[model samples]
Target: MKNISKIFMFLLIIAIPQIAFAESSKIGVVDLQKVLNESAKGKEAVKLLEVEFEKKKKELDIKENDIKKLEEEISKRGSLWSEKVKQEKEEDYDKKVKDYRRLQTDLKDEFQRKNKNFTDKILSDIIELVRTVGDEEKFSLIMEKQNAIFTSSTIDITDKVIKLYNGKEKGEK
Candidate 1:
């Protein structure tokens, strides 16, 4: 009888802790995209990228206009000129068109590369911040809002995290 009591007590001790831990564990969902879009640092990063893209776009437009003008000049007087002059004009126009096309391709590639780099950096930072906040708040699980089909407002931590991230950006750490 004494041995039986001791075994029961041991089992109870083990089970009680597990039950308590399960009850106390907290789970939350956050909209990562929303947080990133709303955060002050994210906004600043977007603005910086936009400014750079605009400058590049303007340069591309100017190059395109120059190419168009060269093409028009060549077309208007090609047959009226001597063979040598016509051939030279055709060569110049071809070279200019090729250069313009190459420049346009490079600009597009560069813009994509820059945009991807900036997005990756921002996402990495946001993930770090989310983990830090989750650990500090003792969240047992944190899920992205996109992955979750539904969650109650009480379990939604999107707004709180955005606030915290913005606050940190403002030197309120």
Candidate 2:
């Protein structure tokens, strides 16, 4: 009877670990890039950035047109004027050209900075939402799809996340 009890104890110990291992872990994959591109907030951010870009582009276009006009005026009248007057006009043209170039560079830099900041902010918000979704769905682990070597479509949660993010942005909850 002692031997039977000992055998039973040994079998239970072996089976306990097997039973624990049999439970599946709930893991999910989220594609952040998809979230950024498909989410409504993300699309709104892109539109805002594009509008700002077009506004800045118009400013640069005006500066460029002014430069072209000055260049043409210099070419048409430079030969008819006295040396001093011609020299002054030439200097003015050079200054305008330099100013236009500087303005162009500055506007480009500003646009790029704004774009980077907007992208970063959106990505940060999405990551926070991903965490919240993971918690609510009882995920044991959530990984970025880009970082994973392979993940099945059944475990991909990007669409669900996007839906939740959009709903959140619209004040649905």
Candidate 3:
């Protein structure tokens, strides 16, 4: 009976700390996607990116149309032209096509680079904010929504974080 009591005491001692830790643990969840999509700065950043890319997109469209027209002309008029003229036209068409493709690739690469930079900057700001929130609120663990298997709405701090982020952006501007 004395040995049983000692074993019981040891188990109780181990379990008590775990129970206390579970009770004290404060977890928070943030949906970064939600914050990025819903925040004012995020929305504005998207609009800016779109506007910045729109001009290049229009230019690409025009270039594509020009290429198509040239292709049509080559097909329709090549038979009527002398060999030299036909060959020259075909060469010009090929060169233009190559130029168009290169420009398209350059534009795509630039857009992706800009987008990643913007996303990184914004997400960096958000993570800083999350850290601040976690510290201030005494959260034991704060996790990204995507990383979690499931989270209760009560533990979700996304809206709160978004509000804070928007306010910070407003203050900055």
Candidate closest to the true structure, highest lDDT = 3
Q: Pick the candidate with the highest TM-score.
A: 3
Candidate lDDT (C-alpha), each: 0.85, 0.88, 0.95
- Candidate 2 Cα outliers beyond 4 Å, as residue runs: 1-23
lDDT of 2 by residue, 1-173 (tens): 99999999999999998787656568899998889889998888889988878987897888789888888887998788999998998898889889888988888788789878988998898889888987888888999999999999999999999998898889954
Instruction: Return the candidate ranking by TM-score, descending.
Output: 3, 1, 2
Clashes of each: 0, 0, 0
Residues 52-92 of candidate 1 have per-residue lDDT tens digits of 88888898789888878877877897778999998988898
Q: Candidate 1: worst 10 consecutive residues by lDDT?
A: 164-173
Residue pairs with backbone overlap in model 3: none
lDDT of 2: 0.88
Output the lDDT of residue 25, model 2: 63
User: lDDT score, residue 45, model 2?
Assistant: 81
> Against the hidden reference, what TM-scores do the models get?
0.74, 0.73, 0.94
